[model samples]
Target: MRLRRHSLPEPRIQSKHTGMLQRFYNDVVLALGHGCGSSHLAGWRRCPPALTIICALTLGLSCKVHAQAAGNDADNANNTPAAPTCLPDGSGSLKARLSGAVQAELVWGNEGTECTGAVRPDGGIRVRFSHKDGVDGGRLVLLFGIAALREGQSAKALPVNVTVIREGLGEFYSTQGDNKCTLDEVRQEPLVGIPHRSRSYRIIARGFCTHPARAVRGNGVILLPRFDYVGRIDFDAEDKDETLEGGAMTAQGRMKQQ
Candidate 1:
């Protein structure tokens, strides 16, 4: 704003030091032009000498401040080191096997839940399961928020957002690995919960690792209806008029009988 109103300041170019400083400023401005909207450095480098001096002076102060800020960050990190966590053996794969009666259920964004909401995936807690190998396995995850199951609608078609995930089992599943993965079958099926009898679905899908690592991968189908539906969803809905319309999503799953 100030620059727009007043004439640019003249650089009192005197000594070789001043010339060197001006060149340095020009280089810095050219390099940083992209951040301010210029796609190429040539345009910014062609700026007037006065503008270059002004930007150079401003950049000089900024560099000093940035260096100080970085130093402070390093000091803070050194002073407040992270708490040591338990290191597991081998790799960070989920150790627990899912099957039969031994089950796991999560209902976040509910009345009593703290995290797993419509917008953000904050407030996640560690959920542990007894591994078949006797190792207590766990994953830190914030499940996507759940909405009321529309009758005759598959859960796959529901709109939900996930925010954050901790570095652990959940991260492994969510983050893509270097090796490609393929699904054998993916469709929505019955999501029958023994206690919570509502519209639910189990994703009937089989995953295959294109390049097997350590001669291992997920076994059987996604167990325990953790998927709760087997279907495909393509969302084209856009938000307009304070609502989402014109977007379409298709789901295929059985709604639990009322």
Candidate 2:
């Protein structure tokens, strides 16, 4: 008795999506005997169950890999760092006029400007104002050696040193050896709306130079007749030598003065 040969019907893909993954799935199906010449249907008929299971698993794994790649791209975008900005609060400003060798009027506000202050280990204060344009634009530094300053307290006629630096000009100090400028009025108060572990205060000061700041390297002088600013100081700022012993001569001497 002669047996008649029968061929299985070709597998059907219903989805019309033409993505790379879809094409890859179609290739995988064809490689598994969907279309491998006249005997293709015969091979699929022999192992339809096994080939169907493999196609399902391959589609699932491809989808998972694509989803994982998309997730990684999103995470990389989120990890990018933000750019630095000026202080948001409207509490920082510096205004001053320079004359003599260097003549220019300087004004800095919270926009495109930054102010920082720290209390030195010797109980002095250092405040700096930097503009977005860098030193060429303008930079001012004030040093106060009035020992310990208390909140809500005001002082007058104290020795204060000033430094001015700008582009096209060299650094200028109030005096080569001694403070030639005076802090006519200075007041301190707690800064509001900011949380800090250590004591922080807003320092407001106005002053004038008794003698112009002489250039560090040249025979130029910058006379700042009047200047004022609003700055901040943190008492617990780190010092140069963090391990100064209590019995250290400098520490003891400061204690004795206190």
Clashes of each: 14, 1
- The lowest-lDDT stretch of 10 consecutive residues in candidate 2 is 241-250
lDDT per residue for candidate 2 within 47-157, as digits (tens), equals: 766677767977787788778789989999999665332344567778888787667677877665666666656556666665544436544443333443553467887
Candidate number achieving the greatest lDDT relative to the actual structure: 2
For each candidate, what is the lDDT?
A: 0.30, 0.60
Tell me the deviation in Å of residue 103 in model 2.
2.8
Top-TM-score candidate index: 2
Encode model 1's per-residue lDDT on 1-258: one tens digit a residue: 122212435357686556656565556654455344355435454556645666677777667767877998999888864432211111111221223222344322112212111111121111111112122344333222223332233333333321112223322121122223333333433334331353333323334333311101222122222322122111122113111100101000111121
Q: For candidate 2, what is the lDDT? A: 0.60
